[model samples]
Target chain A: MIQIKEVVKTYPARDGGSVVTALDGVTLTINRGDIFGIVGYSGAGKSTLLRLINGLEMPTKGEVIVDGKEISRLKERELRQARQKIGMIFQHFHLLWSRTVRENVAFPLEVAGLPKEQIRKRVDQLLERVGLAERADAYPSQLSGGQKQRVGIARALANEPDILLCDEATSALDPETTASILQLLKEIHREMGITLVLITHEMSVVRQICNKMAVMENGRVVETGMVSSIFSQPQQALTKQFVKELQPSTQGDDTSGEVVELPLGDADKLVALAKEHGIRFSVVSGAIAGEQDDCLRVRVDGTEAQMQAVRQVLCGGERAC
Target chain B: MLTGIDWNQVSVALGETLYMVSISTLFTALLGIPLGVMLTVSDRGYFWENMWVQRTLGTIVNIFRAVPFIVLVLFLFPVAEFLVGTTLGPTAATVPLIAGAAPFYARMVETALREIDRGVIEAAQAMGASRLNIIWKVLLPEAMPAIVSGLTVTCVSLISFSAMAGIVGGGGLGDAAFRYGFQSFNDGMLYICGLLLVVMVQLIQMVGDWLVRRLDKR
Candidate 1:
């Protein structure tokens, strides 16, 4: 569990210029067992928010509470102890090039002062879990980007932390690698039940695995809600833009037409009935509306008389038209 | 050409050169590594992040490095006399040798440490590693190859500094060349000493490069 309360972070300019505000009066709560995704473009304060969760950067004016402890006020020594329970993975993977995979994974365990025997056992298990057991002896330079991220994941999970913060964890990979990494993250959340707070500019990443989501712009949270609701009914302009980008494109054609929503099972029936009546119809988009709720959305194009006939069947032949 | 060269004296001089280089290099590494690590960590945004310490140490290293080695040896004559109880032999020469070379080597160490990726250090910190752990486990190991190369360069300089110590009656091949080759006009002895110094430098460089290549995993 994490709570960010009215947090404001400012950094003095390097050239003795005016201060820059990275986060302004931001509040967010990530519940336990949540794969919470924070989506925003660069400079949207997404990374600053993730860093505050683990006390990597202190807020200038507000409190960051994680697991009920105020991270903003903790001393350096106390923060070090607290950080062991909050693992972070980076877009660059941030692995120590001098160390092999096994040693890299054992790093957190060594920092936690685990015994040598215990560390060895734990690292082996972690390597196996991330499917990097065979490459345990390889340096980061020898592995591909995907393998390097697997090592990062193993190293992050070494301490068995209660939360994992991913700062664009898959942003550096190709699309295929990104999908595989995202699937691995989903598996990690399902099996470990660890809370995940991921920040990325990619809306598709959030839609793939995140259960809850937030949209950020210019150092503030513009929108936040369940992923399903935000996808179906985006409230803000930026949120709508993100949701629209995910829609099946109309091939650069004008989208002005009659939009209809029906259950997934009834989609084929409507298409057949429209075909029999000589009405032009096309399926616009389809998505899982909610948990166990599948819906099909389509766009129908025809004359006013033709539209009336389609609505008549749905209105029970009343011809209220 | 070899007739005028005294083989016994040349051997003794060669031994003295080795003695001076080995002792000074040991002390230089011992002093320089910690100074370099301190200079690196005390820098702004590093683990220690102390502006005063970084600036002060940096200034001292620069001051020592800026002085010419011959002049540094002359200036440290009193120190050598006080520490080694004499200013006339290979042992006494090391006092100034380390003083000159440690700061030179420290600067190299700083550069090597600076080359490390900042993200690696941040990763270590995020894992809750203590400051000591970060320095020992992350910074030092990551910069090892460059550090070794730096030491090699420092050791070669130390060999040349030992030759300069001969100007002050600090005994070595340089003293032998000065006494027999320049003063007594024995050109053969001068060539032999010069040739031997070149050989020593080449050997040190070869070893240094090999070690760096071996240590560099990236």
Candidate 2:
């Protein structure tokens, strides 16, 4: 549904008279109905990329094709028209605070010049969908962070947009709220088949809903592919680092005796080895260095004989085991 | 028994002061609002985003703002004479009052517009709202409370300016106070006019605060 071709975005430093390349000749494609995630830290240009897709910002170079239209080349009128099919939510849940939730949701429809009755009906339905029906009369200030985000979601989906762009939609939310919001997003995707493009520094967000994902670093898409493949076997070093960050760790514990690095395929053998030696071992963390194979960093605790047995099984006779 | 006090003259002066302030305020709102909107939209990264246009318009507003209101009233005498055919009464007083106050109000409008979160504007743009629609629907409504409060401040300034308008042959309470009270050495007249001005300012502030609170759901 979206094709970003060699897009580059540069912003001039507001004070220093220097140019900052926000997106440096990056390219990626997002299929329709796919929940695609662009993961990056601050200043990685993921948000900039999202803006380009919706024509909020034109690319300094190359084209952003959304639903077969080159958004970068579109005139203001055409771009605005194109944008009606592309809805967006923000980290801050940028609802017009002066407006009630229902009115805020109705804004896009109003902009579309939908009839008043129709606008009201549609807003009511959207509020129902986002579970904010009772808060229709409440202004944004009265809503909690999650509720505000729900209103943001309702407003974005008001025009029945084909694409929903979430710019850190749940970043400001607490963990529990983030999970609920992610679940809501998944439900929306499942029901409507609307393409979702979310960018965040949070890997757990991508892991939760994204089917396809991209890893952005220093304004470049260093890696991109199916989420499962990327999680199981990350090709780039940065991707491996991100994947590693999500793995459960037993670091900083004073109890564990030995830490072992074993291939993912050796998990069974390691268990059997631990059993033979009467050692207790747990998969503490793991990292998939694509070329080096997926490895589990396990913590093992037991007497010296048990440690010796584990070392013998894994390392064979290569060392002191 | 009270001596040389003329209640009719006091009432007339009050009426003229009200006339000058109200009329000038209306024009200032009409003119200053658009100027302020223009300044905001043309700002860098905003909808219009024209550096030259933004800077030129900004400089103009600044120049007008920098000129002291009294000097501006005097400076605008010729234009006032050309527009109203006389630089001597309430009608003439409105010319300098608007000229002096509009730019100041425009700056206030710009400030109010600036206070709106850029993220809100970005969200509007992302929804495919046209520049005009963003201004009319998003910018104006979101900034309404601040704009109303700013307008209140502008009205208070205009009231003060109208008093100065007395110096330019613009007859109002200030004129009556100056002639019958200061020049004629009538302390009572000055005190009454001063009290009325204070009451008027207080009334404007109270009304403005109420309106702002009413408008601000944020």
i-RMSD of all predictions: 0.7, 0.8
Q: For all candidates listed, what's the TM-score of chain B alone?
A: 0.97, 0.96
Which regions of candidate 1 are displaced past 4 Å? Answer: A248-321
**Candidate 1 lDDT by residue in tens digits, A1-321:** 899999999997888788899999899999888889999989999999999998878899989999999997788889998999999999999999999999999999999999999999999999999899999999898999999999999999999999999999999999999999999988999799899999998899998988789999999999997776577557899999988887857364435556555667776678776877788776655656343336555566778887777776543231111
Each candidate's fnat, in order?
0.74, 0.82
**TM-scores vs. true structure, each candidate:** 0.88, 0.86
Cα lDDT tens digits for candidate 2, B57-109:
99998898898888988888789889989877899999989998899999999
How would you class the docking of model 2? medium
DockQ of each: 0.64, 0.63
- Identify the candidate with maximal DockQ: 1
**Decoy 2 TM-score against native:** 0.86
- For B25-118, candidate 1 gives per-residue lDDT tens digits of 9999999999999999999889899999999999999999899888898899889999989978888899999999999999899999999989
